[model samples]
Target chain A: MKFDDKIPIYYQIKNYIYRQIIVGELAPGDKLPAVRQLAVNLTVNVNTVQRALGELISEKIIEPQRGKGNFVTEDQGTIEKLKKLLITQQLQELYENLHQLNVTDTEIVSYLQDYIAKRKQVQ
Target chain B: MTNTIEIKNLNYRKNYRSILEDVNLTIESGKTVGLLGENGAGKTTLMRLIAGVAKGASGKITVANQDGVPEKKSVISFSEQLNGFSSNMRIDKIIRFYEDVYPDFSTKKYNEMAGFLQIDEGLRLSALSRGMKEKLVIGLTLSRDTKVYLLDEPFGGIDSMTRKKIIQSIIKWKSDDAVILVSDHYVSEIASILDEVVIIKDRTIYTQKSAEEIRSKYAEGIEQYYESIYEGNDIDD
Candidate 1:
C-alpha cells in the first residue's frame, strides 16, 4: 500500500477500497476490516482511514450495521454505478491529457481503437 | 479533562544561549503529529519542554489540562527516559522498573509489543544493537497508557524494514483519544502516518499544516516542501 505523497491520502485510501470492491476481492455484503486494522495495514493515520470510510458511508458504497461494523453495499445497482464512475474518471483523465497534446476528438477515438487492438493482440 | 497539549509563549535558554524562542503550539487529541526539523533545530528541546523534563522556561505548558510539571510528567511518555537506565540492566528489569515507577505502564502492552518487535526480554541492554535498542525504546514508550507520547527520532539509523515494522506497530497500538508527537528530520518514511506536520526553523515554529493540506495545496511531498523552505537560507549544516 505504498502511497503517492502528492495526493491526498484519504482520496488514495478511497480508491484502494474502491478497487477491491470493483475487482470483487471485497465481495458484496462482505464486512470491511475495522478502521484501526485498515490504518495498520496501510501504515496510515487512523483519522485518515475514518475520513475515507465516512465518505464511503455517505456515498452509500458502504453500510454501517450497528455493532457489526461496516459492510459492502448489497445493492448491485450501486456497485454497477460505482464501476461506471471509476471508468468515467479514468477516461476523463486520458481524454484531458490527449486534448492537451492537440489531439482532435476523431483522432482520439481512432487512437483508442488502435491502442486496444494492439493490447488485445499482445494479450 | 480533554487530552490536549497547549504551550503559551514558550522560551528556553541554556548557558546564555537560546534554544527556542517564543514557541507557541497546541496539539489536540486523537492526532499523530510530526514534529519536523533539521538536527539542532530545537526539535528535541521542544519535546523535552513538553514532557516537563527541561526547566527554566518563561512560558506556560499544560498537558491534559494540568499546568504543573509533575502532572505533565505523569501523562507524558518520553522515549529518552531510557537514558537513565544502566546498560547492564536486563530488558525484564527495565520493564519491571517502568511498571513500578509509572502507574500507567502496562506489561500486557509491553509483552505484545516486544513479541511483535522480536525483542527478547532476557537480553541485557548492552547486548542490543542500535536498531534493537530503538525498538526497545519505542516499545517501552508506547507501553504507557498516557495522554501524550513524545517519540524523538524513533526511526533514526534503523533499516527500512525495521522502520516500517515500527510504524505499523505505532499505528496498531495508538489509542484513539491520545495524541502521539513523533519528531524526525527525515519526512518521507513517516509522512503518511502524520495527521499534521509542524516544522521548526529559526528557533521557532516556522509552520504547521495538515499533511493532507500540504499535499493537496503544494502538489509535493512533505520532504520537498520542507526542502523548499530552506532553499534560500544559509543552512549551518
Candidate 2:
C-alpha cells in the first residue's frame, strides 16, 4: 500500500488493515499474513509492522492464537462498532473541512444529502 | 556484546586529500540504516571503513564492541567488491567457493536466492548485466551470516525490476539481530525499507533520524527532507 508520508507509518499500516476488514476483503476469522510477510509486501520496516499489529490485537480488531497467525475478529458486534468508528473518523474530517469553509452543521447535513442524491440521480 | 557499531573520531585520507574527518556515529543492530549523500560525500569511504576493507586515519571503528581490525572483517559482508573471484567463474562455482571460504555462508540460502532472483547457475559474471551483477552481489553478501551488511549503491546502474527483486531478497534474508547499511543517492527507491537515515554532507555525518520521525516531523518523505536540506529550507515541507 502507498502511504501518506504526513502520517506515522504504523498508523497508516493500522488503517490499511482496518480498511481490509471494513471492506470485507478480510472476513471474520480470516487469517492475516505473517508479520514479516506483511512487512515485506508493504515495504515497511518490521518493527513498524509489529507495532501496527500490536495495536490491532489490543483493539480486538485482529486476534492472535498460539502458534497460528493473526486473524480477523470473529465477533460481529465488535466488527460493526469498528466500522462505525472508522466512518465517524472520516465524517469528522469532512465536517472539519466544511466548518473551515464557514459551513454550519445543518448546512453540512443538507449539502451532503443533496450531493449524494444528485450523485445517485447521475447514476 | 553491544549489538551496535560505534565510529569514534574516524578519519580517512587518500593521496594527501582528506575524504572523511572526525566522523562519529552509532548504529544499533536490527536497523536498516541508509547512508544518504551526494556523490563525493565519502559515503563509500565510510562503508569501506566500517567493513574494515580500508583503514581510517587516527580513529577507531568498533562493530559489536570490537575495533576495526583485519580479523574483524568476518563480521561484515560487503555487496560491492567480489575481490578474489575471477571474471569467468560461473555462478555455481562462485557459490561453492564462498561456501568453502566463509564458514558462515549458507549454500541452501544461496540456492533459494538464486532461484528467486532468476540467476542461472551456469551464467558467468562477465556475461551478466549490471542489474544481474548487483543481484549476484546481494545474494553472495547476504548468504554470509555477518553482524553488518554494507550495500554501497546496490541499486546504482541497474534496472527497476532487478532493484525490486534485490529489495525483496534483502527483506527476506536480513537477520533480525544484525544490521544492514545501504548507501544510495536515490532516497525514494530505498526509503520504504529504511528504519533510520544518516545524512552525510561535506565529508561527515550531518544528521541522523528515524524515517518515521522525518515523516512526522517534516510532514514529508525522506526524499523531500533531503531536498529541503539542499534548498536551505529545512523542515518547511
Candidate 3:
C-alpha cells in the first residue's frame, strides 16, 4: 500500500501484487490485506486501495468474498496463462517501440536477448 | 442507489447580490468529492441548499432524491463548520443520540473509533478542546454508515499532528459505496485525499477536475493553481 506520486496508485498496487505473485512471495490462496488496513498502512485513500483490489478481482487474479475478504486465486494454470499473456503484451509493446525507432530485425533480436539476459542476471 | 445531492441551474441571491448563479452540480453514487472555496465564496450556501436549511432561493436541490430535500435525514449527514454542537452534551450522550437517530448507526464502531482516536468517552463536550471536538465530529459522522457525508472545514482550527490524525480517521471510516463531500479553505492539507477538486468562485462553479489533472494542466500545486485563478480575476486596481 506504499504510495508513490510518480505513478497512478492503482497501477502501482497492481504491479506490486503481480510482482509478489511472480516471485512466489504471495502464494496462491493467500489472503491479502484488507482495503482499510492497507490504506491506513500506506497513508492513502481507501478508495485508491479499493480500486486496485477491484481491478485485481476483475482480472480473476483475486477473488473477493463478502464479509470474508479478498483471496489470491488458487488456479496455478490460469496464473501461468495470465503471466504468458502479460509477457506477450509487454513484448509486443517493446517490439512496436523498437520498430518505430527503425531498428533492424537482427539488431532488435540481439538487443532483446541481451536485455533479457541482464534482467535475469539482476533477478 | 438514490442521488445523494443534485443541484440544477441553481441561482441564489441575497438582497439583489448574487451568491451563486447557474450552479449545476451533483454528488452521485460512490466518490468522495472535495468542495474547495475561499471565504465568502458560497460553499456554505450550497451546503445549506442541499440540506434544506435555506429557502426562497431559486434552485432545485434533491438530497437522496427526496421530494424537496427532506429535513436532513439519516441518509445525508451534514457536519457544519463549528456549529450544531452543544457544550452541555456529554460524549456518551451524543453517541446515544446518533445511535437512536441513524438506523444504520453502529455504536460498536463508534466506540472503537473513539478508542482509537483516544477520545475520553466520559468527558463533556465543553471539557474537550477544539481539536478533540473535531475528532469527535469525525468519529460520530463516520459511524453512521450513511449514503452522503458532507463535512465543512473538517481540518480547520486544529494542529498539524491532529489534522493528520483526522485525515487518517476519515480515510479509515469511508466505504467504497459512500459519497463524502468535504469543504475546506485548507486545501493543501486534504489535497492528497481529494479525488476531485471543485472550486466555487464569484457565484459560479469556476473549475472542477481531478487534482492530478489540475496540477499537470496548471504546472503547479493545487494551492498555487487556486491562487493564480483568483489573483488574475481579483484585479480591482
Candidate 4:
C-alpha cells in the first residue's frame, strides 16, 4: 500500500485493489473492509479512500450493500474484462518504454518471440 | 457543501509585529487539512484565531455555521497546552475537568482514545513525558464532539510509534461533517493523511490545494511542493 508520491493516491488505491482481484487474492463477492479499516491499513486520508471506493462503485467493480460494507462484484464477465484491461495497460506501458528505446513494432514482435523462447529454455 | 470553517480578511498584530495579515481560507467538512509553514510563519496564530483563544485578531472567522462568538467556540476544539494545567493533576482529573466544562466532551471516546494511546489514568501531568503529554492533549482534544479540530504541531519531536498511533486515532474518530486542521512542521509524516494542504508564507495564506491534485498535477508530494515553493518555484495549482 506504499503509494508513489507522483500519482493520485486514490487512483493508486484503486489499482491496488484491482491487482488483488486479478491475482485472485480478493475473490469476487468478498466484502471489503470498512472504509475506516482500509484507511488505517493504508495510512491514507479517509476521503481518499472514499474516492477510490466511489470510483469502483461507479465502475461496477464493487457495489455497496445497504447497512453493510462494500463487496467485489460477483459478475465473472466483469472480472474477466478487468483482467484483460490490466494486461493491456501493462503491455501499453512496456510498449511505450520500448518505443522510447527506439524499438519498432517488428522489433517488439521479435523480442516477444525471443522472450518466449528464453522462458521455455528455463522450463 | 458549505465550508465548516471560514476565515476572511483576518489580521493579527502582536507587539507591533504582524503575525498574520489578510488571511482568507475556507475549509469544507469531511476534510483533513495540513497547515504547513516554516518557523514564525503564523501557523499557530491562525489556529488560535480559529479557536478564539488569542486576542487582538481582527477579521471574520466562523465555525460550524456560526460566527466567531464564544458560543461558536463550542464547536471548535483546539489542542490544549497541557502546561497550563497544574503539574500535580492526574490524567483522570484532567479528563474530568474537560468533561465537566465542555458539554460536548465524550467520556467514552476519551476512554477509548486513552486506551489506544496507553496513557495511564494515574500519571501526573508533571511526570508525563513530552510524548505522553502530547498523547494526553490529543486524547483531550479529540474527546470533544466538535465540528472543527485544530491541532498545532501534535507530531513535533514525537516518536514514530506514537505518531502512528495518533494518526490512527484521527482516521478512526474523524466525522463526515467535521474538519480536522493539523498544523505541523513535519511534512512527510502527515502528507499521506491530508486531504488538502494550506500553505502559509510571508504573513498570508499562500495557497490551498487538494493533496491528490498536487500529486497528479505536479508529480510531486506535498513535502516536495512545500520545498519547491520555498525555493521560489511556481506551482499554479
Give a tens-digit lDDT track for model 4, residues B125-154: 899887888889899999899999989999
Candidate 4 residue lDDT tens string, A90-119: 999999999999999999999999999999
Report, for every candidate in turn, its global Cα lDDT versus the true structure. Answer: 0.92, 0.87, 0.77, 0.89
DockQ-superior candidate, 2 or 3? 2
Residue by residue across B118-218, what tens digits does model 3's lDDT show?
A: 88869998998889988888888788777788888877789988888888888887777788888987777776677677889888888777765655454
Q: What does candidate 3's lDDT look like per residue over A11-85, in tens digits?
A: 667787887887788889989888888777666667777788989988999999889999889999868977887
TM-score, chain B, each candidate: 0.96, 0.94, 0.89, 0.97
In candidate 2, what are the lDDT values of residues A1-123, reduced to their tens digit? 787765779989999999999899999999999888998898777878988999999999999999999999999999999999999999999999999999999999999999999999999
Q: Report per-prediction Cα RMSD to one decimal.
A: 2.7, 2.1, 6.0, 2.0
Query: Candidate 2 at residue A1, lDDT?
Result: 74
Which numbered prediction scores highest in DockQ against the true structure? 1
- Over 4 Å off, model 1: B1-3, B232-237
Give me the chain B TM-score of candidate 3. Answer: 0.89
Task: Look at candidate 2 and tell me the lDDT of residue B85.
Answer: 78
- The reply for model 2, stretches above 4 Å from the true place, is B235-237
Worst 10 residues of 3 chain B by lDDT: B228-237
- Chain A: TM-score in each candidate? 0.95, 0.94, 0.76, 0.92
| Alpha-carbon deviation at B150 in model 1, angstroms | 0.4
DockQ of each candidate, alpha-carbon based: 0.89, 0.65, 0.21, 0.75
Best by TM-score: 1
